[model samples]
Target: MFAEADWVVKLVMIGLIVASIVSWTVFVAKTLELRKATLLANQVRQDADALRSLAEAGDKPALAGSAMVQGANAELLLSADALHDPEGVKERVASRFDRHEAQVARTMTRGVNVLATIGATAPFVGLFGTVWGIMNSFIGIAEKQTTNLAVVAPGIAEALLATALGLVAAIPAVVIYNHFARQIAAHRAVVADTAAALLRVVSRDLSRGTIAAARG
Candidate 1:
């Protein structure tokens, strides 16, 4: 059926097929990336809570395997006077966590725009092909001087095929784009919550350090 299409129609079909393929590919990649990011966010939140509990119990064990904890630890180690101003220390620690959270959000949402583009523009492209096919059909009718059904049927069929192909490519792309949008928004919320948990731990530690310094 595609081979019988006019050259312009053929190109349109090919473009729609490629767009569909790209949309599905992005869907798979984004799904995996979001899953990983969500898991990491959960792990970081749990580790931060554990660290906070340990601090309250007077046992500050080094936390490993969590980016938020590792970043806070690095900052604390680098600045001996970090606790001199508790607010300043909290700001710096929160900044570090925010950076990591932003990075995770970006990673989870990469390639999602491609799906949006395919969904929004594919149907229009297919419509163009249909219009072109019908125009050619009308031209053939004028040149051949015939209103015969046999002569017109093939052209109309080819024109309608373009519209069908367009819908076929567009429907899935739109559905997938919406799905990822929801998932990404939820993942970002999780990351924000995890960042908040880490910030609480940093604030508590800074407060303790400031009190001890004042007594010294």
Candidate 2:
């Protein structure tokens, strides 16, 4: 198996090993990032829910922990007399929440592209190594002026090894990439839910403020 493989095929195998290592690293990093993002998004949802309850009770200060909530509260506080403008209040809160959602999504998506690229390329790299190995094996047979199973077996074995190695690298990369993608999608959903909760809080506050103004 060793004798039939040319220098080029060996080099390709080395390159594939490097690629596999890199792809694995990206998978690990992305998994960690997605887990962290999911946790943070859950926290945000809880915080937003609490803020919504406070708003329902005519208190906007309950949203102090969340920057999106804080911005909404600040806006409501600033325009104390503009109680009739529920639409404006809703828009401001939605905008702030959207910005936060975008930020969170950006963080959650990190390293995913690297994983994706590795998954797509690793197989081709392995195939190249196999092709190069087979060519070298044929060249060796030609030079030796003999076609023997023993002589050809090594080259074929090396080619198959290269293909196996490529698959070994690629399969994990593809799996991890898909896993990360699902995590990101879930993260986005949580963020969107939190944003909706924030909007509700802001809208409730606006409605209460309007009623108070009419009474005055």
Candidate 3:
């Protein structure tokens, strides 16, 4: 059917094929990316939970480059100049976590929008190909002045093939796009939990410092 398809229909089929390729490519890449990041995030969160205080989170070689670690470290430095006030420190750390979470979400969401675009537009693009194929077929039939089933079948079949390709390209794109959305949301939640855990560490460290100052 594709072999005999009109030039316009062929172009539509090629475009749909490219869209399908792009959608699957994104799926594979994101699956790997999300899997790796989630594992790292979870590990970092667990390590942060086991710490006695932010001081115990020192160096963080194992947790290096993690959003939780970076946010906590940056805020700890900035908060130190505030006279180790726990309330001020925790508030600032929380703000940094918010930005870090947003940044992580934006990073994870990269390239996912193409899936949505393919899913939403593929079917309509196929419909256009189908319409064009059928219109061309009708024009030929009119010129030939023939109503034979054999004469009518091929054109109709070719036109419908465009719609089929469209659906083929569209359905999985929609499904994968939704799957990525859920994955990203789950990762975001993990990040929030990590932030909260580090916040507790920050508070614990400040409390100990305050107590030591009182004794001194």
Candidate 4:
């Protein structure tokens, strides 16, 4: 079928195929990343002891990928600064947690835009090829001066093939893009909830002056 396709149609099919491949690649990668992030957020929420252990270790880079851990660690650092007012420390730590939550959401959503672009444009690109192919088919008919089935069938079949390929590439892209969008949103909500838990821990430690003593 590809061998029979016009050069322009062939290029369109190839481009759409490539786009479909890239969209699937992005979907798989993002799915894995979001799963890991969600797991990390859950761990932080479920195990206060482990969260404190991470902060006490002062190994900021060890679990840098976990937004909850990052926020907890930042709160520890802020609490350790003796010169800063207690109220000011809480504000700074809260700000840092917000930043980490935003970063986690952004990281989890990376590469998803490519899927969106492919889903939106692949059909139109295929339509362009179909139109081009049909135009050429009509030209062939005029030149051969025949309305014979053998002469018209092959050309019409080739033109329809572009539309088929276009839908093949587009439908999955659209479905996957929407699925990832919803998944990412849910993951972000989890991250935000974990950050809120960390903030509560920070508040309790500040009230007891435990954070400063731990720093000492």
Candidate 5:
């Protein structure tokens, strides 16, 4: 296997290995990041709800003071107001949702492109190495002025090695890319659910607050 490939093919195989490793690292890192973001968003939404409850009770200072919680509260308040005139509120809520969706998508998609690139390109990189090895093998046979299998054996082995290495690098990348794609999809689902929950909680709070003010 070692004898069949030319140096160039070996180099390509090495490069493919490096690329695969880099892509996998990105996948792992980004997966963790997305998970963290999802958790943080959910926590912030929950805190916002608690703060909204306190606010409705006329409690002083609440979690709404936190920047993250404040944003969620503002979004909720804006949405509840727009409910009375949906046409006006619809645009604003949709715009806010769009921005949040974009942020969630950006977080989920981190590092996936690199994984995709590795999956798509590694096989071809291996093929190039095999072709180069075969060419070198043929060249060796010609230089020896013989059609002997022994003269061509080393080049063929080198070509096969590169091909094998390419597959090794590419297979994991493809699998990992698929795995992360699913994970990101799941994370996005969580974000959507949490955002909806936040909207509902805020809507209720707004209604209560309005009733209290009316009675006073």
Candidate 6:
């Protein structure tokens, strides 16, 4: 059917096939990225939660990709002059966590817009191809002056092929985009929890009145 499709229809089918491939590629990459980030979040959250104080946690070496411990320790060193006020330090630390979390969310969602575009536009693009093909078929019927089923059927079948290809591309992209939305949301929550756990340790350290701070 595709082999007999009009040039315009063929182009649409090719583009949709490419779009579907791209969407799946993004799905695989984003899934792996989010999984790794969540794993690191969990690891750091557990480590931060076990800390007796930020000071004790500070003595430990930084985990390679985990940001909570490193960023928290950096904030402490930056605001060491104001460590006398736990409220002030906590406020700054909290703000830092918010910014970091936002950045992580942005990174995780990098390729998601491609999926959104494919989902929204693929059907319409395919419709255009089908419409063009049908118009040509009608023109051919006028020239040939025949209403025979065998003559009419091939054109219609080939035109509808474009719509089928469009749906093939669009449906899975919509599904993947939705799945990623939920996964990314859950990953973000895990990050927030990790930050909160570290913040609690910082509070404990500040309450202890330890003027000594660790540098990242």
Global Cα RMSD, each model: 3.7, 4.2, 2.9, 3.2, 4.5, 2.0
Better by lDDT, candidate 6 or 1: 6
* Model 5 C-alpha lDDT versus the unseen true structure: 0.67
Tell me the number of clashing residue pairs for each predicted model.
0, 0, 0, 0, 5, 0
Question: TM-scores for all candidates?
Answer: 0.87, 0.81, 0.91, 0.85, 0.76, 0.92
* lDDT score, candidate 6: 0.82
Candidate 4 residue-wise lDDT, 100-144, digit = tens: 778876787688888888889999998998898888778889989
Best by lDDT: 3
lDDT agreement of model 1 with the native: 0.75
Which window of ten consecutive residues has the lowest lDDT sum in model 3?
207-216
Tens-digit per-residue lDDT, 66-106, candidate 1: 66666766776666554677777778878898898788777
- TM-score, prediction 5: 0.76
Where does candidate 2 have its weakest 10-residue lDDT segment? 54-63
Candidate 3, which segments miss by more than 4 Å at Cα? Answer: 210-216
Query: In terms of TM-score, how similar is model 3 to the real structure?
Result: 0.91
Give the worst 10-residue stretch by lDDT in candidate 5.
54-63
lDDT of 5 by residue, 51-121 (tens): 44424423323233433234554654645535465345434544565577778788577668777788888
lDDT of 3 at 70: 68
Clashes of 6: 0
Error of 6 at 189 (Å): 0.5
Which pairs clash in model 3? none
Candidate 2 to truth, TM:
0.81
lDDT of 3 by residue, 111-198 (tens): 9999999999999999999999889788878988987777777788989999999999999999999999999999999888888888
Q: Write the per-residue lDDT of candidate 6 for residues 71-144, one digit (tens) a residue.
A: 77778888878877889989988998999999989988899988999999999998998898788778778878
In order, candidate lDDTs are 0.75, 0.73, 0.84, 0.74, 0.67, 0.82
- By summed lDDT, the worst window of 10 consecutive residues in model 6 runs over 57-66
Better of 1 and 6 by TM-score: 6
